[model samples]
Target: MAIFTENIGKVSVGKAVTWDRDAALLYALSIGAGRPDATEGIDYTTESSFGIQQKVFPTFAVVLGGSGGSMDHLGDFKLHQILHGGQSLVLHCELPPQGSVTPRSYMSAVYDQGKNAIIELTTELADPEGQLVATSVTSMVIRGETGYGPRPERAGSWAEPGSEPDAVIEQATSVDQALLYRLNGDRNPLHSDPVMASKAGFPRPVLHGLCTYGMAALALVRNSTLLAERGLGSINARFAAPVFPGQVLETRIWNTAAGALFQVLADGKIVLDRGVATAAAAVAQDAAELQDAAAN
Candidate 1:
């Protein structure tokens, strides 16, 4: 509570980062995209599968700002009790297949619930050319750290999910899900160590929250009428429960004027709730993006 109040607007500038096609392909595979020996969609999991056809997955944007790891000064707080609350991503432009980027991250807001505290963070991702690519908003909730400060009003992510859904997509996670995802450079011991899991009050190491989010996002885009090349306009969702590796996730979706509404159920529990996704054609976005002219 004291730490978050002290750093409300402080910005953290990350060192330069560079990634290539192989990085993109591995990221795709980590999220359960097509496989190397896939009869179709081979370009996603295999960098050398196709020359010009290979493309980067839009969800890969989540990893651009250091695999969504801790920001510069966020280490000041006790992170062992921290849980990823939710994430919302707004894409300003298509992410490059191979490029260098530096991030500007800041503490946005803090919401003090009765039993937990929600710390909000926003990071701007920019290419070496200074072109803004994406904006990621993440919320981390620290459990058992409540009552230290006055309760702050909840914002953006507190909405509840609908009881009924228009559609549902079920996806199964591999037993080695966390192992594969860690290769993307987010080797957080909390997601990989059983000892760490026991210390954290879980039965075993849990799957990355973003891993579940990525699978849900993939289902949202693939099932929509929008073209895959166009991708999504905005994506948001809440993380409610821990998902173990090899669990089956059922993502329920509802089409709406804004785009879509969704919630994910795992092991008979809602793991991701209050979700929203929007889509727009790439040509329209590309033209509007060219008009902005803002650089990092």
Candidate 2:
């Protein structure tokens, strides 16, 4: 295995990436928006007062400064065997309708867990003007790839659900989700061309994992009834299963003192298991004070 300790600092992966209207449209389509049968019925492409504006999906930050060949460099790691363990994003500002963005990525930390290795990466995106647009932190748990030496300490997992969720929100994907998402400049082919997918060991074209992540975010924003209350502060989730296009995703949420717990289920199976989001405490505090004043 490669020791990335020396690489755990500021690293530039790519130059300025142009963000345009087409990119925004594709991202919206990837997440099941703008479909003929969409439940939300929001036209993201058109200038509308409702629905998300022509903005890049928050989760796009993960791919921004990605090193094209990290897996190849890591010895003994079967790239196919590795999975995206979790994703989280913090938006510093609303994505502009169109602009150029430069991202700086770096290895934030590495945790050796005896049986597994947990790698953390962070990327910061800035507009041409040097204004911060967004920041993302991703954690990848390399299962069964550990024991190079003594283990390191890491944060504990989120508290497991002690009871059933309080509410469940369901959203179905359009059959063209993968195809549309690819237009967002991903061009991975794994999500579109069937031949490519088969080569990757998938039965058929699978939706971009990030597409599902965006859908889960939409579910959380809608279900928590906090879209207008709390600006999206943070979203963290694990991809439990591959969701093909045209599958219905059911997101279950539980309100907590810290934030909200969530899970995305498809066809009665948990696809995004063990998800959690932390909202800005400032909003929650303000809401509480309003409630107290009303009670008085």
Candidate 3:
């Protein structure tokens, strides 16, 4: 508890991050974006389409700031016992197809949850002019590292709507989905090495939580023009269960006046729940930005 609290609010050195059109396209394809049966979102997958201009997916912010892996400032903990508990992101504006940003990250809080502990991290991504681009909040659960005293305040139970879903979309994940997603910066062996997965008590390598979250966002944006017009203003969800590769994910969404509530199910079990997404106002793309994206 002492170590965790002491590190809170201490900003780490900023890291310069850059991405190109290829990276944006790869991120889109990794999240099951471009398919023959896809109704929309070709702009995300193709760089030089006729009338469509390529755009970055809002969920791509997860990789823009990179994972908070430099945890030595905090006390040592078992790596295998850690898992992504939840993820949230708020985009300040539409991300260009290619751009650069400097990510400033810091430990936000630590909550003790009986046999586990939840470490919260906040990262701010900014452009070269120091304008905020996106803010990300990540919760990491460390098993068997509890008893430090502070317990997180319980959030209200998420009740499912009684009416039928507004939309239900099923997407298939490729067997190499995790492998492809790892190229985005997360190289955790738990998502790749079968031996490491077994040691962590899993039958096999599991898909990245961010990947699953991105897929959920993909389903929503592809299905609803209202949400995809500009891009997602914000989105958040809790990781309830592990999603193995090659499994089909069914995302059920319930439309609300503000935005929507959603859940992702794998084989009838909820893998992501307590979801919320807000749509951003549609913005026209600038030709200069498009040309810059193409050049770099």
Each prediction's Cα lDDT score? 0.76, 0.68, 0.83
Q: Estimate TM-scores for all models.
A: 0.84, 0.79, 0.87
lDDT of 2 by residue, 211-237 (tens): 888888767665675442564556778
Q: Candidate 1 residues 23-71, lDDT tens each?
A: 9988888877762235555666665654646677777888877523454
What lDDT does candidate 3 reach at residue 1? 33
Instruction: Name the 10 consecutive residues with the lowest summed lDDT in model 3.
Output: 281-290
Clashes of each: 0, 0, 0
Residue 26: error of model 1 in Å? Answer: 0.7
Best by lDDT: 3
Q: Which regions of candidate 1 fall more than 4 Å away from where they truly are?
A: 35-37, 49-52, 67-77, 145-163, 227-229, 281-296
TM-score pick, better of 1 and 2? 1
lDDT of 3 by residue, 73-169 (tens): 7667756677789998878777999999999889887888667888888999999999989889898888877755695563322457889888999
Instruction: Give, for candidate 1, the lowest lDDT window spanning 10 residues.
Output: 151-160
